[model samples]
Target chain A: MTPVLQIKNLQVSYYTDAGRARALDGVDLTLTAGEKLGLVGESGSGKSTMALAMMRMIKPPGRIEGGQVIVDGTDLMTLSEQTMLKARLSKIAYIPQGAMNSLNPVTRIGAQMVDAIKAHDEGSSRADIDRRCKLALESVDLSSSVFKMYAHELSGGMKQRACIAISILLKPKVIIADEPTSALDVVTQRQVMETIDRVQKQIGAAVILIGHDMGLMAQFVDKVAVMYTGRIMELSSVRDMFTDPKHPYAQALIRSLPNLENKGVFNGIPGMAPALLQLPGGCAFHPRCSKVMENCKTQRPPSTNISGGRILECHLYSEKA
Target chain B: MIKLIIRRLLFLITVIWAASTIVFFIPRISQKNPVRERFATLAISGGFSPKDLEVIIASYNTKFGLDKPLFEQYTDYLSSISRFDLGVSYNKYPRTVLELIMDSLPWTIVLLLVTTVLSFVIGNLLGAIAAWPRAPRWLRTFATPFILLQGVPPVLMGVLLLFFIGFKLKLAPLGGAYSTGVIPDWSSLTFIWDVVWHQILPGLALLLGSVGGWTLSMRGMGITIQGEDYVNFAEHKGLGGYTIFKDYYLRNALLPQATGLALALGGVVVSAIVIESQFGLPGIGRVLDAAIRSNDFLVIYGVVLFVTIAVATLMVLMEFIYPLLDPRIRNE
Candidate 1:
């Protein structure tokens, strides 16, 4: 499969009165066309930051320090600000984290969708744009009548689906859905996830599904990238990840999930994720890693590649390699 | 919506009735007789003797129906007000209060309405721009001076403007509604231009003083709205800065500001009184001022009633218009 989106050593930092917070610390990720990558991490593991930095939507105090976000063979970092704007929602669209408020409340859903299309492709006829927008709405399991509704008029599931419809309006090459199913119930969450899954397949767009729900991630994603302190600790097929995880952090994360075998018995990873402002030397997860060696506290391990295209970043994996 | 309108209108009538009744009795509490007060000011100037003044006052009271019992006069006042017959002005003899208000109403309405609207537009635009993160530095600078000017009351601004623009610079007329000797003709463009020109200074005072308030409020609202998830998502949708600012940013921010505009329009009477009197424009403010000094109780009642009705009606109109601006309010 051709890689539709590639992040090379992506680094993002937030300048503050206290100190610079390295949000995305030399992060690297790749998602091929039509593939779903579940990015599972605890809160503030740079999941949302990575999404924003890809779109270059980071507000002030937070800056994309350096990175190459190459989508469909085009290096987005090299594009001019004007071209970057056109590139967004056309080349790489972002379905925002807060689906509840991701749409303009004062405008009609059809208007919001139409405006997005207009912003990107201005030469299209009004009728054509209307048809496409309505079609996009319908594809997300919403009626074409939803086009005339306001954000407040829709249910939580409908709003999320509406956001998904908007993201697919331009048939973007890469769709980054940042926690789209949050603030939804289990049934609504499954529905929203299914809508996203169906839409991604229809558009042939790679999707980076960011969430902390291991169960939901297990069901929807073909592959999983376990993140810790702004870096992916392991990336592997979902089968190997749940069956035989490599990285100690990924193992801990998987073990932390509630299973039928561990009924009413919760197993949480010890210690907290390190602060971005002052990450521990070597591996940022060294403080919490159960399989830490003496060298693990001094030497940050490189990403070790194994058979079947799996990746693990840890002293144990590299020592074995 | 029809139910809401009817409910609001009924509430409005209750408020107006309460206000009219209070206005009727408040002036009556004073011991001063309108006829005697009117003649005293005229006599001081006319050099009239007081030999038959008491008998003349009694006869005048009888003629004006002021000799009736308090409850009887109140019922008569209410009945006459219900018919929209504001009694004749004691100060301006034989001229009805409604007639005086009508003659002066147009001037105040035009000046106040134009100034209020101009300031609202300028202020909201400048304010929204000022708060916009992507707006050019120079475009944002326009709001600061207005915010600073908000501290200077419109009445004071009028005095300063009159002194500089009128007296010192001679850019416009010193005072009054039109050029001293021009006959008022609605058909003549020059007369209208002259009237507008004469109003420039007072208009400026009102505009400069008021635009800041709108800018401040709008800027504050814009700050909140621009940071909303929808606005950020609009950017993520790759919308141009102008589209985001106008549709996503300004449209949402202007919701509360629109309501503020209604209240601003309603509250302009105090400013109108100072502005119209200072500029010597023949607006209701000046007429009301004259009536108050002469204790022309009926004319005072008439002006108060007019202002109350205008304010109450505008508030109701604002309520009906609000849901159109904010969709969330529509269902509620």
Candidate 2:
């Protein structure tokens, strides 16, 4: 089956007083139709930058330097600013980090949802738009009455679900949820994830879930990608990723989680995440890698396709080849 | 909501009572009889004093209920005021205070109310555009001149406008509500046009001075509002710039500005008095100025009470409009 979304050589930089910070450096990823990819990393690991760059929502001071985000065979980079607006939410919908303050408090939820639908499909009737909005709300397990409610009236979980309802209004080819459940309680988190999972399946759209919850990733996503600095260190099926992680950074990240065998102990990777402006030479993860070697300090690793459907980017794998 | 309005009405009555009471008693503290004051000017001007001048003053005071005990005078004043019986003017004589107010109030309301609202609209729109990132640089800078003009006091601004635009340029009439020869004709559109034409300089003075303040405050509010997540989300929803600007950006920014509008209404009469007197317009401000000069206690109390009621009523109306604009204030 053909992939629905393909991002190649994506690079984003922020020009600050100190220097240019390479937030996303030559990243590549592909998601097939109906596939779910969980993007996990530490804070400042360019996870959200990747999501923003995909939407071409990067503001001033931060620029998408170079990239080809081809969604459903259309290069989003080539579209005009006006067309780019239409492309967003219609081609690639984004569910924002909805812990708080996503919806407009002054307007009713129905107007918010209806506006998004109207923005894309201008010719649709008010009745048609209302039907679609209520339908989407219902699909997310929210009551149809929520359409008439304000953002403040809804509970936190309802607001998150309302955001999900808005994201799926057009049923875009790819959905990028940026830590959608970070503010939710564990029970509500599961409900929201299930809602996202159900909606993605219904729309047959690929989803990129960005968060630090590895357990949630294993439970929900088909594949997992571990990001370090600005690059994806490894992309693998969730089974192999948890069973046998290849990149030292990915291995340390998985090991950091509390497992049955390691009852009370956590194995956090040593050393701080270096600032993007001052990233080390060659390999970014070298200083913190348990398997650091001389070449690891001087030579950058290329992404290698190993046996089975997996991708690894590490000097250890490259050295053997 | 009904309860709220009732409470607000009761509160409005209390405020008017307190204000009118203060106006009534403060002028009396000087213990100078308005009747005597009125005739004293006449007596001094003629260079001859009537031997029974005190008798004439006493008869006038008793006629106006001013000769009663202070407490009885206050109660009589409250009762008469409640009945809307503002006594005859001492300076203009024979014309009741209410008649004087009724004659000039339309001029003040039409000019000051229109200018206040217009400045608010023009200033806010300019401010919003100035703060909007998508607006062209020149369009954004359009609000800058207004901001600079905001620091100029209305009085000075009026004088300068009157001097330059009125006297030198002759772009508008020097002062007065209308031309000298024009007969007062409410049915004639030309009469209305002449009235409006005469007000241009004073209106411009008030507009130029106050528009800048709205632009300054609105620009600040616009900047903060554009950064809100809802505005950003509106863009991400693929909304047009206009849609986001109006619904998400401008609508939210206007919440605090509406309160500013309410507070700004209180200063309307003050500016009107300054601009009207400078322009020689016969608005209620001129009436108040003449009343204070001649110590026409009834006229002073009448005009002050009228202004107090209008402002108090408007502030209460703004409170009602507030909940409509901001839903958070509703259902409380």
Candidate 3:
């Protein structure tokens, strides 16, 4: 099966007051057609940075430093800004973070959705556009009357649904949803996720679900990649990653998930990730890893595929063994 | 809305009446007595009769009914205000306070209203361009120099421009709307030409410094509005550039500034006293300046009251008009 989106050795950096800071470093990932991949990382782990770099949405003082983000077959980094804008809304839709504030407050919800569809397809008739807009809203379980209501009048969940509906209306080949449920309550989060899942199947599109919640990712994504310190620590099938995580950082992350029975008690990963401007000499996570060896301190680990179709960047599993 | 407007009007009327009454009493109730001043003037002129002066003063006071209760005095003041008879000029030879003000009122309104509105419109447009991201380099460069031009005082600007453009160049008349030989005509075209010709110097002086501040304000407002989340959301929704600027940014920013401008209208007219005097223009400002210098209390009081009422009424109108511009402010 041909991969729908292929990001090869991508690096994103920002020029801050201090100096140049690498946000995402050499990220290599792929998603096959109709595949759902979960990008699980804490804030500042370059998850959103990677997604924004793909869309060329990084404002100046921040830019994609190196490598390519190949969406379908076209290399996005090579495309001009104007062309990229066309690709952005039409081919690969982005449901940005803070979806509630994403719609214009003065305009009615329905007009904005139709505008999005019209922006991508100029030749589409007004009647067809209106029909698609109503269908899109209905698909998200929102009332058709919501189209008539202004943005401020809609509830937070409804706004999120409206944004999602607008993003997916064009039936883009790939959807990059950056924390679509982070601002929502638990129940609303579930509904939004279920909507995304249903839309993914209906459109038969690839999706990159980037968020910090691992348990939520497990419920829907076909694969999961745990990232830390601007690097992918582990990539595996969702079931395997949860069952037996090899990377020590991945293990610590899974152990940190709160237990339902003991609500008050939680195990959190010890120590902070290394600063991007000052990454450790070798393995960035060595200081935080429990099984850190002498070799792990001064040498970066190469990503090696292990048994059970799991890939890990750790010195624990040797090729000789 | 009707009740709100009515309440505002009533409140404004009460305030104006109170202010006018206070002004009326300043020469009488204050330690600098009008009686003493009158006596001093008579004595200086070699006229003798303290007893005769006292009787005359008493009679005069009684005739005006100043010996009555304060509330009764206030009622009389209100009655006189309603009739547009704000008493006679204490110093001007044979003119009532109303007559003096009426002569200059038209000139003041024409100068102030025309210049203020023109500056506001022009400055705001330039400001929007300066704030627009895609605005060409020429606009950005021009705005800087224009702001520098704004810093010059209007009086200085008036003197310089009057000397260069009027005296040296002889491009326009030095002062007044028409030549001495020409009679004032009732024709609409000639009347407009007369008004425009008389307004040239004062208008240019006012525009010189004021437009800069207006431009700066509009530009600042544009920048601030551009940063608002709604503007970005508008862009993301693919709104046309001009429409976004007009409805989203300009409309919201212009609301409060428009109110400030309206409230300033009366003050602008009153405050142009120096400019009018310098140009020899027959406006209320020039007349008010002369009245104050001559201690013409009645004329001074009348001009003050007229200005106070005009400003207050404008403010009330602004309050009523605000809701139509900003939907969020409606009913609040």
Best by DockQ: 1
* Model 3 CAPRI quality: acceptable
Which stretches in model 1 have alpha-carbon errors above 4 Å? none
lDDT of each: 0.91, 0.91, 0.79
Better of 1 and 3 by TM-score: 1
Candidate 3 chain A worst ten-residue window by lDDT: A99-108
lDDT for each residue of candidate 1 in A41-143, tens digit (9 for 90 to 100): 8998999999999998888799998989999999998999999999999999988888888889899999999999999888999999999999999999999
Tell me the lDDT of model 2 at A51. 94
How do the residues A1-321 of candidate 3 rate in per-residue lDDT, one tens digit apiece?
898888888988898898888888888888887999899877788998887787776766888888888888999899976677567756687776787777665557877777667656789898888889898889888888888877767788888888888878878778888888989999989999999999888888899999987878999899899888778989999998899888898898888888787699888878887788888877888888899999998888887888877778888875433
Give per-candidate clash totals.
0, 0, 0
Greater DockQ among 1 and 3 belongs to: 1
List model 1 lDDT by residue over B246-319, tens digit each: 89999989988888888887789999889998889999999989988878889999999999999999999888
RMSD of 3: 4.6
lDDT of 2 by residue, A240-309 (tens): 9999998889989988999898798978889999999999988999988888889888888988888767
lDDT of 2 by residue, B249-303 (tens): 9999999999999899988989978888888999999999989888899899999
**Location of the lowest summed lDDT over 10 successive residues in candidate 1 chain B:** B323-332
